[model samples]
Target: NLGDALAAETGFKIEMIPLPMKRMGPELISGNISFICYTLEAWLPSVKEQVLWSDVIFNNQNLLVSLGAKPITSLKDLDKKRVGVVVNFYYPNLEDSFNKYQIFRENGPNNESNLQKLLHGRVDYVVLSSLEYQYQKKLQPRLNAYDLGIDTFGVKCAVSKKSPLSVSKINQAIAAMKKSGKLDRIFRLP
Candidate 1:
């Protein structure tokens, strides 16, 4: 979707190279990748020397979700329970908050394996995006889901410093797309 949007806006033949999110920072720094779509917190520190944030594409709220015979309503309820999370800047904050609730358990990086751990009772709950939860539920109907209200954060496209000109054009195109409601339309497309 992003490749199509970038191509249509910039008139450039954009080719997307899919890589695991964990490897994106190093790739960007080494000039192996031009840009990356990721959370602001994760991209900020890694790109301090050679990259700058271009524009925000979406805002996502992370949820602490649980599945099983019991329902979770508050952070305190997660005490001594295993929680799954993606490795990112937000993990520290999550860890601090969980510590306050006396919730200490295994923490694993986000991946299919970690998700499987949660699904199979290896972890007590998983912290992830609400969209991810909904999508996963469709794949596994027996699992219960709960939303633990949390901070909302922005998702953005980061550009390497070597491509300042490209960033300018991309930002301009993004602004136009927003003004024309093209971005909203594209995102809502089924």
Candidate 2:
């Protein structure tokens, strides 16, 4: 819906392609897909030259969550526990931090799988974006979240290295939308 709104507002028709987030890296690198709409942090420096970040669509903060248990308050609290994490660039920070105290186990594919693991006691806790966690909590009221004082980041649409046309157009459209408040209106829509 947000992609459609951006297309409408900018007069640039964006092809909304849906793929599992886990496969996005390989697909984008192999040119199977030309663009990805995800958090800016997902862009690895190795692939950075192939992509351009545009338009801050959402603020994503990683959160530690568990099922109705006392919220995990510190890195020390994670010791010897299995932590579910999504695969990709975001895991490096978590891996480095959590490995210091615990045996970290990654639950891959997507958030649904990770959440299911937490629900079924396959893992002690999971790391996810706050927005995603909130949405999931609506589906599973038994879950609880904790903030670990990490800086929140922006989500952006990334264009492939070969698609200079798309990148240029998208950046221009995003700048125009930002100036005109169109982006704000789109996000505010119910």
- Cα lDDT, all candidates: 0.67, 0.70
Query: Which parts of model 1 have CA positions greater than 4 angstroms off?
Result: 20-22, 97-101, 105-109, 142-145, 179-182, 185-190
Model 1 Cα lDDT, one tens digit per residue, 134-189: 66767877666665666666767777665534777877877887788887676542
Report the lDDT of model 2 for residue 60: 70
Worst 10 residues of 2 by lDDT: 41-50
lDDT of 1 at 33: 71
The candidate scoring highest on lDDT is 2
1-190 per-residue lDDT for model 2 (tens digits): 5577566765755687677666666666776666766557454555655556676765677888899877677867777888887665455456666546565867567778888899889988888777777678778998888888544777787766655346667777767777877766655422
Pairs with steric clashes in candidate 1? none
Residue pair clashes in candidate 2: 50-161
lDDT value for model 2: 0.70
RMSD of each: 3.2, 3.3
